[model samples]
Target: MGEIMGNFRRAINNTSLSRFRFYFQAASFLLLIYGGYLALNLGDQLPTFACIFSEPRGGSCYLFGLQHQMTTPWTSYLSGRGIGLLVGFLTFIAFFIVFNKAWCGFACPLGTIQDWLTALRARFKIRYANYAEPTFQRLKKIKYILLALLILIPMAIGNSFFGLPKLNHDFGVPFCMICPGRTILPLFSGDFSQLALDLSSKSKMILTALGLMVTGIFLSGSFIKKRFFCLFCPMSAFHYIFANAALLRLSKDAGKCSRCGNCYRACDVGIRAIADDLQHKNIVKDDCMLCGKCVEMCPEEGCLQVKFLGLPIYQSTAEGFFKRMQGRNNAK
Candidate 1:
C-alpha cells in the first residue's frame, strides 16, 4: 500500500500542473459561461462571477442576489422575506466554504478572461507588469471598501437608516452597475446591449459610463498585468471573511520553505507573502486564489500544499520539480 501510494504521488507530481490548470479552467469556463443553453442551473448563490447578465450563465453570482435581497423593505426583517434572505446567505456560505476562494481562481469567467489576455500578451512577447509592494498594499484595501459599499448602498436604498433619505431606485444593484462582468460576459453570447448607456436617470447614466470605462480598463490592463481586476474584486473580500473555516486550504511548511522566490514569480496576483512569510502555517492570504501555482513552482519537497480537511492533496517535491523542468526542456 505504501509503495502504491508513493507511485501515485510521483505520477501526479510529474504531470504539468500548469497544463492541468489551463484545461480545468477552460472546462469550468465553458460550463459556467455557456451551460445555461443546456438548461443547467447551479443556483443563484454561487461565490464566483457567474454573471446573471450573461444570458447563458449556468449559475448566478451571490453578490447580485445579495444586493437584490438587501433592497427588501425594512419591515420584512421579521417576516418570511427575512428568513428567505438568511437561507440565501447560508447557501452562499455553504458553496463558498467548500473551496474558499478557488471559485475566483478556477471558476470566475472574468478571471479566466484576464488570464487569456495575459496569455495573448505572452504570445506576443510582451512583458507583464507588477505592482510595487507599497502600491499593492494600498490597492488591496479597495476590495473591502467596495464590499462595504455593496452592502450599505442597497440597504440604504430600501430603508431610511440614521435619517438618511432612501436612495433613488436608479442606483439598483450598484456594484453590478460598474462591474466589468456585466459588460464583458454578455458579449460572449452575442449581446452588446449592455454597452448602451442609460439616459433615463442621472444615477444610471453616470453608473453606465463608469461601467464602460472600467470594462475598457479591465481589458487593457489585464493584458499588461496579471489578474488586474482581482485586486479590487469585492467578492474576494467577501470570501476572505469565511476563509479560515474553509474545507480547502493552502498550507505552508515554514521549515521546508527555502524562500527561493520561485513561488513569488509564479503567482498570478503577486502575493509576496507566499514567499516571504515564515510564521504562518495557514498561508492563504486575502489575495490568494488557491490556484496552486506556488506549490507547482516550489523546488523544495513538502514545502507548500493544498489540503482538504487537513489531508494534503498536492505538495511540492524536488523530484516533481526536476521532472517538470525536464518536460519543459524536452518540449522546447
Candidate 2:
C-alpha cells in the first residue's frame, strides 16, 4: 500500500495534464450557463428546479420554490435549498472533500471568468500584488467578515430583533445577488437585465449601491487583483468552512524542497507551500482554489501530489516505496 502510494505521488508531481480536473471544470461551466439560460428564458415554463430565495414573481418555476417564501421581509431568507442550489452545494462539498477546492480551481464558473480576465491582464503585463506579502495578506480576512454578515443579517431579520427585513426585501439573497457568477449568468444568456429586479424609489437606491459594489469588483479585477469579488463572497465563505476535510490535497516532500520559491510564485492564492510546515502543506487554506498550477509548476518529482481520500490519485510512478528504501540504503 505504501509503495503504491509513493509511486502515485511521484506521478502526479511529474505530470502536467490532469484530465479529471479539466473535465469537471468544463462541466461546471456548462451547467452554470445552462442554468442561467433556463432562468432567463424558460423560467416561466419550467417547474422551479431549485430556487432557494423566492418564487419568480413572474412565473410558475419549481425546482426549490422555498426561496420565494423566505423573501418576505419578516422571514429569514433561505436560498441555498432549492434543487439546483442543493445539487450545486452538495457537488461543491463533495468536490471540496475529494479534491480540496478543485471546484474553485477548475469547476467554478466565477473562477473561470476571473482566470480569463486575469489572463487578459497578464497579456498586457499587468498583475495584482501577491497575497503572501504581509501588507496584502491582511486583505484575506475581509472574506470571513463578509461571510459572518451573510449569516448574521439573515438570522437577525428572521428573529425580528431588528428590522433587517427591509434590507432583505430590496436585495434577494443579498450575498449571492452580487455574485460575479450570478452577474455573468445574465450576460451569457444575452440578457443582462435578467439579474435586475424592478424596484421602487427606495429599492432603487439599494440597487444603485449593489450596482456600485459589483462595479467595484470589475474595476478591481481590471486594475488590482483578478476576481477581487471572490475575496468577499459568501459562497467562498461556505466552501472554506466545509472544505476542511477535502480528500485530495497538495502534499509536499519537504526534504526535497530547494526553497526556490517557484511553487509560491506559481500559486494563485500565493500560499508558500515549500516554506510552510509539512502539516500545513495540504493546500487547505480557505483561499486555495486547487487549480493544480502549483502541482504542474513544481520542478522536483515526488515532491507534490493530489491525494484522494488520503491516497494518491491522478498520477503514479512505477518505483515503489521499497525502491526508495533501497535507494536510501545504497546511499548510506
Candidate 3:
C-alpha cells in the first residue's frame, strides 16, 4: 500500500499535462462524432459557446446531432410541460459540473477542428497571429452581443410571450442560419447538402449567404490564429454565467510564480491577464478553457496547477517544464 501510494503521489506531482489533453480531445471528439453521448444525453451538448437562444427554441443542431436530444427537452419545456426541462437541465448539470469548460478543451468538434488547423499551421511553419490587449478586449464583446441576439431573435420568433412584440416566425433558429457550425461541421460528416442555398425564400437565401460568409471567415481565421472562432463563441458566454459549480479548475500560487509570462504566451486565447494578475489565486480567467496549456508551460515549481475539486492533479515545476519546453522548441 505504501509503494502504491508513493507511485500515485509521484504521478500526480509531475507537470506537463497538455499531451494528455490532446489525446483526450482526439478521443472525445471521435467518440462524439461516432455516436457517444455520456448517457446524460448532452453527449451532443453544444460547446460552451453554443447559443443558449438555441436552448429553448431548438433547431440549432450541430453536425452529428450530439445535442439534439438535449435540445428536445428544453424545447418542450418552453412550450408547456416542465418535467422534461427540469430533468434535462438537472441531468446536464450533474455531468456538466464535473468539467465545466473542459467540454471546450477536450470535446468540442469545432474546437478539435481548430486544433487541427493549428497543427497544420505548425507543420508548415506558418506564423500565427496573437491579438494585442486592446483589440482582444474589443473582440471579447462580440460574443456577448451575439449571445444577446441569439436570445432576442428566437424569443422574437415565438412572438406572443404573454403579449410581447413578436419578431418574424421565418426567423426560426436565427443563429443557426448564420452559424459556421451549420455550414462547416457538416462537411466532415460527408454532408455537402449545407452548401446549397435555398433561393426558395428571402430569409433562406440571406441566411445561407451569411452562413457561407461566416464559414469562410471561420476557416480563414482558424488557419491564421489558434481557436479563432472560440473568441466569439456565445456558448462560452453562457458557460461563464453558470460555471460556479465546476469542479475542474486552474489555480496559481503567486508566491511561487516567477512572473515569466510563459503561461500567457502559451495560452491559445491570448489572455494576458493570467500573467498580469499578480494577486488572485484562482488563475482561471473567464476566457480560460482549463485546457492545461498555461499549466504545461509554467516553469516555476507549484506556480500553476490543474485541480479537480480543489485537489491538485499536477503542478508546475522547473525541471519538467524545461524538459517539455525544450522538446517543443526542438520540434519547431
Local distance difference test, each candidate: 0.91, 0.53, 0.69
Q: Tell me which of candidates 1 and 3 scores higher on lDDT.
A: 1
Each candidate structure's TM-score, on Cα atoms with residue i matched to residue i, is 0.98, 0.68, 0.84
Ranking by lDDT: 1, 3, 2
Instruction: Give the per-residue lDDT digits (tens) of candidate 2, residues 224-245.
Output: 5755656554555566676757
lDDT of 3 by residue, 30-131 (tens): 555443223223433444333222222122223212222222323555665555445555655655678877878877767888888998998899999988
Candidate 2 least-lDDT 10 residues: 44-53
Whichever of 1 and 3 has more TM-score, that candidate is: 1
Candidates 2 and 3, the one with greater lDDT: 3
**Least well predicted 10-residue stretch by lDDT in candidate 1:** 12-21
Backbone collision tally, model 1: 0
How far in Å is the alpha carbon of 201 misplaced in model 1? 1.1
Off by over 4 Å in 1: none
Off by over 4 Å in 2: 1-14, 18-24, 35-96, 127-132, 162-168, 194-201, 219-224, 279-281, 314-332
Candidate closer to the true structure by lDDT (higher is better), 1 or 2: 1
Which pairs of residues collide in model 3? Answer: 44-66, 44-67, 48-235, 48-236, 49-235, 49-236, 50-235
Local lDDT at 32 for model 3: 50
